[model samples]
Target: MTSLPEDPPSAISEGDRDTAVQRLQEAYSQGHISHEELDERLHQVLTARTRGELVAALASLPEENAGTTSTIAAAAGRIKRRGAWRVPRILKVESAYGRVRLDLSRAVIEHPVVDIELQLGTGRATITVPRDATVEFEDLRTGWKDTRYKPRARSRPGGPTIRICGTMGYGRLKIRHAWR
Candidate 1:
């Protein structure tokens, strides 16, 4: 007898649910998905407690952030995100003798929280966010490199959260916030 597959845990957090909702709304706005489809998917998103369910609900619609371009700093190269650029929810960065800078003061933030994962080898990564937004850095393994995460507040609370997680090898990771 073929047994049923085990279900994924239904312990999704609020942040994940909000992110899924944002995706559904974006899909509907893009016209790739109809109202009926969006309604069905959105219901699933709101009710979903597991990552698998959320992923399944959003599997049919095209990723709203598909057009959002990601920046990369290759060896001896520098990549920056400034001006009016789309702020991707997930940013991947790697550099050897290079730099990656992202200024979120005027960028389009699609989610409540942004996750930046990086692996640097003798390089530097800088992030500039708005003062209203909250920023946190965790699990950074910088091997004898300079690091700075100073974000002064000038705006009220209840803004988007930015989580930076990565490993640094002989590199610097600086995070600062601007009043905009």
Candidate 2:
């Protein structure tokens, strides 16, 4: 006798839906899917009842990178990363006396979580994250100025989380979310 068709896949939970939505969003951001496709797949993921349905929503998307750690150091200049640059899983930035600007609004971030460790001697640093991202700077230590960040009341349901850590000696750090 058939074993009840292998007991079908289990029902998708809220966490599963959230994760699927996040994967869709990431795929859209990486230019893997169009806006219209993203919207359609988002709807499908949100309304999916079983794991199979949820998996179908993300069938053709490319797998995310395994991620690697990279470092950017400067003696007395500006460290800037903008445009459609690829963001690694872990980034270490060291500057003796220069400004750091990391614009992730249009960057390609494959990892769900990104950690930025900064060692600044002086000057200001401005980091612009994606509109739906979550910024965490609780582990940062500022010697001269405090981190300037205004957290939103509610972030997107399934957005990436950016963790900022390390030390800023006599410098200011400003973190802001990208504007729509």
Candidate 3:
């Protein structure tokens, strides 16, 4: 088997393309790229078959410069991001033998998409998102009962998208849609 030196093709997993999609959407929301450009690149990112192709989709975007704002809800404590608190671009929640609730139904989102990472240990997390918002939580194990997030169609533009990724052991994270 011979490989092309210029375009060395490698399998591009959905995870790889998803990261590129996230970057493209962020660039579009930040006004770094036009809507038409976003649509074009998004198509490429979604349909990319090779690593080279996915890499090209994000080749033009600037490096990630967005600052991350993190928080930890320790054991035996409860934390809530509610009321008028300004939503940060990146929010991290770590709860150990505690409970954490992020009520995004009333949160003032500063970005079109928010990346939230959770680290839970024998704790519980409840996320409340607005009726219009979409949540994508990857494979997560919550003790004996695994949290199952049904995959929906790719989120539409102009609405908030929250991507939650993390590792949990003997803990549970629940997402509830706004009621109203």
Candidate 4:
């Protein structure tokens, strides 16, 4: 007799699930994912009720984050470098929330900073940084329950440094970094 197919979370699609996992893994390796936080997100992705829910969760993630294929990159999003010597990076993203602009360009790049600024209009966000990179926060506030920053290891020199600033009209924000 033929065997039955596995359930969605179990038989999670490679594209979306894999993407999400990879993003999660990258964040973990970069010292951006804490054990507890990782477990929680993993559970969410696996047990999500609908494809749209999963898609939204994964799609609204920060760059260099970890997870499997479930998370797909947001298209139509833009990241541009305005300056020359000290690149002034600008990220303009349109999500379920309104518009948002993230300014970095001047962020120290010696540690290979990868600043990820997202406009999460009533949406969630996930940002991952190198294991040894330093992290600083400013004007951080959240309305979602259990809003917290996942702990991460510090990054070595030349490793990527990620700075993520977002406007959450109404949502959660998870920032993972490489710092004490």
Question: Which residue pairs show backbone clashes in model 2?
Answer: none
Q: What is the clash tally of candidate 3?
A: 0
Tens digit per residue, CA lDDT, model 2, 1-180: 654333333354565676678888999998999999999999998888865577678788876555568999999999999977778889999999999999987776655689999999999999999777789999999998999999865565445689999999988999998874
Shift in Å, residue 144, candidate 3? 3.0
Judging by TM-score, tell me the better candidate of 1 and 3.
1
Off by over 4 Å in 4: 1-88, 97-111, 139-147, 153-155, 177-180
All candidates' lDDT scores?
0.72, 0.83, 0.70, 0.44
As for lDDT, the candidate ahead, 3 or 4, is: 3
What is residue 174's positional error in candidate 4, in angstroms? 1.4
The TM-score that candidate 1 achieves is 0.60
- Per-residue alpha-carbon lDDT of model 3 for 60-119, expressed as tens digits? 687665576867567668877775455678888887767788887656554557888888
In angstroms, how far off is 163's CA in candidate 2?
A: 0.1
In candidate 3 the C-alpha lDDT for residue 154 amounts to 37
Model 2 lDDT, residue 31, Cα: 92
Best by lDDT: 2
TM-score (all chains, Cα) for each model: 0.60, 0.66, 0.56, 0.35
Q: Residue pairs in steric clash, candidate 1?
A: none
Clashes in model 3: which pairs?
none
What's the residue-level lDDT of 129 in candidate 4?
A: 38
